[model samples]
Target: MKEKRYIMMVGAVDDQLSQVRASLTETMNQKNVITQWILSRDGIDAIGKVDNQKFDAMIIDAEAPRVLNADFLNGIGRHRNTNDCNIFVMSTQDQEQLHPNLQKYAFLQKPLQTEILLQGLSEALSQNLKPSMVEKFSVDVRVINALIKATMMVCQNYGLDQVDMEKPTPKLLELPWQGQSGAYLDIRSQVFSGGLILSFEKNVFLKIVSEMLGEPFTEIKPEISDAIGEISNIILGNAKSEFTSYGVEMTLPKILSLGQTIDQPAGSVSMLITFGTPMGKFFLEIIAHPRK
Candidate 1:
């Protein structure tokens, strides 16, 4: 997969926030970069999201109700994973009056214009950007394509407006998959076999379930588990013909709880792929092994 860029937009709920988001989305979509926009409604939430997840760039409103602290800015620059992450400040104040550290970043005037916002973002991304190059698993491209298509179709069926899929990153068989929000299924075939895991963050899982069921759900109940399994089944069912071309078949899906781990076989190869949505992010793990 091509390198994906994650951006954080920080400001209060207002027209300006909506405008900035639209501008950012257009700029990123044009580049075909699978970008994730983590909307932070206030400085405090922005700080928390930046600390927890990695971001490629951050656009902050200086006049926000909860003013961003200098320490927060410093922290973003200091974090090991995000040291290269670019910061762009939006304000009407003079840049000269701001802290010397903050002055180093790009600045945009208020009432954000699409042309200017795009220019600033393009420049920020061009600096010291490194492409992600990971080894590929031995799975056939057809299988990968089918799964990717299934994922997108499922989300669209549930009313999601945008779905961004990143390139698949290879992984060793032994390393346990991260996160507990997922459903598991077994892949069977006369020639090869493995397990498939569809994982999501807590909020994303709930949102998907709500959409699939046509109702709102705040908790992960037993029925929610069944819904996720059914969705997984649908994806597999959608991709059944593609896998059949390779002489493979998928079994019924089972709910994987938050703490359970997969026991992979020796010498097996796998790839981890992630997708971003307005609600949150989700990932897929495909582990494949040749049957002896």
Candidate 2:
């Protein structure tokens, strides 16, 4: 028998719903997943109808002021049909304050990137068929930027001197050890183990250390390596709170390592962000996978 298709609807304002519908339609076409969709202005009415119908997934555009309210989200969470269906929220506002009861739902941000949204949808839909331990998710650009900024602030607080800070560019480099290196952070979640691996150039590492230690250029040391690992741990801590609010659990502490090269795993996505500081050029490579 052919696989059962899914349904995705927009429960938000007219303009916001229109945008989501267009983006979702294009994404579904590419995946070739048959899906039914609709836009509903009233949350109560929408949930009432959805409760009686069947769908594989639902995309809720929380950007709409009327529908973004707590009561509305709560209503959707209470719906019976929603239990087995994948729920995705699209919003421009900070999702940290979303109703606690709605925390388990997935979310996408406004001005959505096609690839990112598609990847999120694919992962959510494939969740059931795949082994629970094999399921995974990625960090949104907004969250990633927040984590990077927090790391920089932590470095400053520790008296590290700042260097050249510039936007990250997407490019591949031939590393002496790892061969071709892609310019992006590939984040993932592991069922058994949880931690993050950050990849960056030696120069970037030196600059970050100098700023954090409030010292001038010097040779890398065990102390500096320890400090870098602690810094990564802090970033992960801050990022985890945001993830937890969305019903994603993260383990305590982050591990850091310094090496000439890193090996990229198969079936992973990459996000590239560049930073230029007065101290020097630094690139942050985030490779997150299951600990086990």
Q: Number of the top candidate by TM-score?
A: 2
The TM-score values for the models, in the order shown, are 0.49, 0.59
Worst 10-residue lDDT window for candidate 1 reads: 131-140
Q: How much is the lDDT of residue 224 in candidate 2? A: 62
lDDT score for residue 83 of model 1: 80
Summarize candidate 1's per-residue lDDT along 21-137 as a digit string, tens digits.
676666555555556778877777777777778878887777765645765666767776568777777777755566666655655545443444554465455344443222111
Q: Provide the lowest-lDDT 10-residue window in model 2.
A: 176-185
lDDT of 2: 0.50
| Model 2 agreement with the true structure over 80-189: per-residue lDDT tens digits | 66667767766665456665555456655454444444545555554545243233544443344445656566545644456333433333322322211112223433
